[model samples]
Target: MQCMLRKQAQLWEGAVLTTVGASKLPKRPKVLVWIPEIGDEAIVRIRIRKQNPDLATGDWLLLSRKTDEMRQTLALSTDKKSLRFLE
Candidate 1:
């Protein structure tokens, strides 16, 4: 699958929703999704891009084409293809 590095709005100021597991505290880094879908609120194993700092093992994310501005806060799962990288 394709992965893009984008930002999502957050309820708290100065705090962006970088991943599925970003907290208000600054100590914690943002996270990315490994799978294409998050069934529950549990953390799942994922292969995130090295260039993205906000993406961690358990952070939330919004994935899609750059053209679409809509951001959906959800977890993801891998596709049938072995390839699991995002642009």
Candidate 2:
């Protein structure tokens, strides 16, 4: 018989991201961006007063954490919901 071990996954910081999306609400969806990256899907939490409303399915954006000053490039989401990662 053979035995295998599983490895733990790394965790990311969560933030209150503000962006625009396709929804019926006046304000954007309140989403928790844990590991936002280029080409990843995300939801909006605040209304972008001056941001463009012309977003596509593969559009990207820069996201940042509240504790860190570094901003990460992430994929914008048309679906209004929280962001999550898969194993």
Candidate 3:
């Protein structure tokens, strides 16, 4: 599912709330993101490359699938707001 990062909240561990847009409804479903270590690695690389310590909000993430409770993050928006994925 495709979702847009809305906000990040710290509750016990870091949690990101995203707005899921899959239908035309007044209420958009909000889900807590379960980011894995692999995804975190990419995020860290982006931060280091851009030299921005802060996490980027409003970024888009495309999740491909889930396996054993781990969601596979397929693609992510760069600091320049461009999409990039593993080829």
TM-score per candidate, chains pooled: 0.19, 0.19, 0.21
lDDT of 2 by residue, 19-72 (tens): 466674454333334443322233432323124343332332334434234434
For lDDT, the strongest prediction is 3
lDDT of 1 by residue, 1-87 (tens): 123322233345666434455655344223233344433333333334344434443443334212223332433432322123243
> Mind giving the per-residue lDDT tens digits that candidate 3 earns over 1-87?
223233233343667555667674343222233445344545644654476435343453333434345554343333332222211
2 or 3: which has the higher lDDT? 3
Sort by TM-score, best first.
Answer: 3, 2, 1
Q: What overall lDDT, based on C-alpha atoms, would model 2 receive against the true structure? A: 0.34
lDDT values of the candidates?
A: 0.35, 0.34, 0.40
Q: Which ten residues in a row have the lowest lDDT in candidate 1?
A: 1-10
